[model samples]
Target: MTGTRSVRPGIRFAAAGFILAVLLSAPRAEPPPLTLAILPLKLLDTSGEPIDQGPEHARRLAAMARGLAEDLDAGGDYRSLLVTAETLRARCPDERPDCLLAVAREAGASRVFVGVVHKSSTLILQLFARVADARTGRAVLTRDLNFRGDTDEAWRRAGVFLAGQIREAGP
Candidate 1:
């Protein structure tokens, strides 16, 4: 009777361990590896036309992509092949990878990111971003990022938001 009572807790613990082991051993899904192309950071004028090329905005976009890659690398979870703003500006539009498959092959990336900037209302600036898979030519993620700033602040916010999205977004 004494041994039976004492073994009950041990049996319970064993059952719990078995449950935990099964849970841990269960198969987990994974995101695939791919290259990401970032288009030039276009700053639309007050008239809603792309007229200004804010150096700061351009730099921010490039930095944002790089930062996202860096953060992912630190965790050792995924890899990002990011192209710089300078390359986008330097290349001809026809030569650039605005399309997914084209972007992936040209930029040597598996995915592509195309973004547009629009000044919404008076206080908010909208950064419309889209992610496309180069292999499948499908949009994986779509997000409208907003920033509160005139010039420098806008890019800064864009950078931060891009980083956050990448962290929250898998692969």
Candidate 2:
């Protein structure tokens, strides 16, 4: 009986060892990427000059916003969803946190990104950006970037830099 009991325990120990080995060698499943809703970039002209709401300026803003989304999506950390201007104006005209969060929830996003370009002059622009939790409207990341020149290249560079910053900051 003692010999039988000893053999049973040895077999159980070997079985456990085999199970542990299999578990340790199995590949882990990575979590799905988080969905992010990126709102249209708002242009606020504080340059004290006449507001240039021309088509060219509007085009640049839209392009910059799209570039940011592409940069972020390229990282594979976030699935970027671009929000249209008409939807933004119609759903969240005031852009309050609650309103934005609602929009994000409606879009099936886990997070929301918002940005504003403050053009101080023909040569200077400031970018204010934030990422917030869609469910709680809590800010996860915020960054302010200052870049010179009003050209398309300058704006594109700024968007790239901001995207890198957000990725590094884990937003």
Candidate 3:
């Protein structure tokens, strides 16, 4: 009978309050960066003999990381590049493992990716994919994931896992 639809004042007020709360609590998203450089990888295999400083180990890890970076680009709308360990060591002969960061900075990358390979019969893999500020070496984000498989397939699963993370993270 009233001019407006008949509803209790408290009910109307509660509905309005809920609407306001939802508006305030909704998530906001931003686009990811446009370019990323995938730096090289190191093998940390523990066994009767070490795999470090060997072409077989180092080249495989580097190729796998590059593959990952390319896969990430598919979902991220980003540019992917390989920053080779040879080029890095050429610039800084006294290269510690972390010196790869400097090369990424040189490549004009906003984000740098790094990984370490751990090999075993079951292939316990620990991959450190960190996005860092190229200049200061400050880590912006990191994904630490593990995989158990034959060594090569472990690389593929880990790559898929990383690509999903990059996509979900919005670049």
Which numbered prediction scores highest in TM-score against the true structure?
Answer: 2
**Considering every candidate listed, which one attains the maximal lDDT?**
2
lDDT of 2 by residue, 1-171 (tens): 989998998999999999999999999887777889999888888778675556777898899889988998999888899999899789988878898889988999999999999988989999999999999988899999999998889999999999999889874
lDDT of 3 by residue, 22-73 (tens): 9989986757556777777777765445434366656568668867877876
Which window of 10 residues has the lowest lDDT sum in candidate 2? 48-57
Q: At residue 84, give the lDDT of candidate 1.
A: 53
Residue 73, model 2: lDDT of 91
- For all candidates, the clash counts are 2, 0, 0
Question: Which sequence of candidate numbers ranks them by TM-score, best first?
Answer: 2, 3, 1
Query: For model 1, how does the per-residue alpha-carbon lDDT over 1-171 read when each residue is reduced to its tens digit?
Result: 999999999999999999999999999776655456555455564644355545655665556556656665565544556665455445555554443356456767766666677765446677787777877767888888777765665666676676567657756
Ranking by lDDT: 2, 3, 1
Against the true structure, candidate 3 reaches a TM-score of: 0.68
Q: Which sections of candidate 1 miss by over 4 Å?
A: 1-33, 47-53, 84-92, 95-100, 120-122, 151-154
Better of 1 and 2 by TM-score: 2
Error of 1 at 1 (Å): 43
Residue 65 of candidate 3: its Cα lDDT? 82
